[model samples]
Target: MAATEQQHERALEIFLDERPELRIELDHLNPLLAQAKGETAAQYRAERLHEAFEAEAERLGLFAWELTLQLTAASPQDYQAQRLEVHKEVAEMAGMTWADYCQLHDL
Candidate 1:
């Protein structure tokens, strides 16, 4: 079934509850959001969310996109597969084996 706006909002609410510290960032960004209109608001919010995720990923010693995938995956298996795939791609790009890359990153 397709998710509803209310469901999305509830999911966001639950996510915020689990990560109260992010609320401060959200609060800080809300004024910017208020000033934006329509698509601009959506884009601005997406950028801010990406920035927030990037910051958190840095803190956690992970790539921002990787953290995003990890957090947003529909299931544990999905996350695992995506995580491995991303790592493998990154490792190939870096001219390293997956095992070596993981070891270097302490993953």
Candidate 2:
């Protein structure tokens, strides 16, 4: 099953709890990590964290959404399945067979 919003939030909480330094790095990288009206500190931090992840993903020549999926997936197998499903959808949109698309992208 796809990850829910609660799961994503929990994952982020756990990730941050495990890596306090990452929060500092994200805050440093994203100067706009300030709380908005009606937004909690956690919410602002989560938003900045996402922005930081997006920047990092772009720097690494990776898709931000895919990176998010990888980060939030329940397991490696789940991530692979979700990733393959995404590729299959993209292949369909591009009017290419899965095998051809996979080969073209070295998947």
Candidate 3:
């Protein structure tokens, strides 16, 4: 798998933790990865995985920003600051300011 795919997969795994029902949805996702033999196919498969993840997230009333906020809120004060800093760095890498990222995601 590509690094990006691995990153997304790892994220999805984290999100699925403690949720067996969500883990089952991953079974539907695995075949797509296996079938992706070339760059174009892999990209297409990645998009499908993204769509699937979004659908499942919506069904569970989960949002990326909400999850991030929950994690930050649950962290120790020192860790919370570190997490926010990391989040801002990630947002910048994704081509958005931290404020814009929060706004865009309704954080």
Candidate 4:
């Protein structure tokens, strides 16, 4: 049970396979929250899932992608160091842990 570059790739491929649905989920994650009473300000997160995918894809020189992101906000000056989390849905399907996720991404 060794993890290799190909295994890493397969993990990411699983993510890309569900990318469209993931994008939709992000947009609809909190419809109830959006409709909840009393909040004067409306907060909607930007839909940059595509861009994030594209950037990583291009940067890695990979045509098809297999990765998902959860954001990180570090500090005022460390904005760029806020590397996004890359998920592969093994969390739900395979009962993968956060530690596993971190290990997979070399965090």
Who wins the TM-score comparison?
2
Model 3 / residue 28 / CA error / Å = 9.6
* Model 1 misplacement above 4 A: 1-46
- Give lDDT for model 4: 0.44
As for TM-score, the candidate ahead, 1 or 3, is 1
lDDT of 1 by residue, 14-53 (tens): 5566777776666566555546554455566656655665
TM-score, candidate number 1: 0.54
Clashes of 1: 0
Per-residue lDDT of 54-101 in model 3, one digit per residue for the tens? 776577686544343333343567445644665676687899977898
Candidate number achieving the greatest lDDT relative to the actual structure: 2
Candidate 2 deviant stretches above 4 angstroms: 1-19, 25-48, 59-61
- Model 2 has an lDDT value of 0.70
CA lDDT, every prediction? 0.65, 0.70, 0.56, 0.44
Off by over 4 Å in 4: 1-57, 60-94
Q: Which consecutive 10 residues in model 4 have the weakest lDDT in total? A: 64-73
Candidate 2 lDDT by residue in tens digits, 1-107: 34557655665665566677886775564334354345666566667777766776688776665666677788999888987887788899899998899899889
Query: What local lDDT score does residue 100 receive in model 4, on the 0 to 100 scale?
Result: 87
- Clashing pairs for predicted structure model 3, backbone only: none
| Candidate 3 local lDDT, residue 43 | 60
Better of 3 and 4 by TM-score: 3
State every prediction's TM-score relative to the real structure.
Answer: 0.54, 0.57, 0.34, 0.22
Number of backbone-clashing residue pairs for each candidate, in the order shown:
0, 0, 0, 1
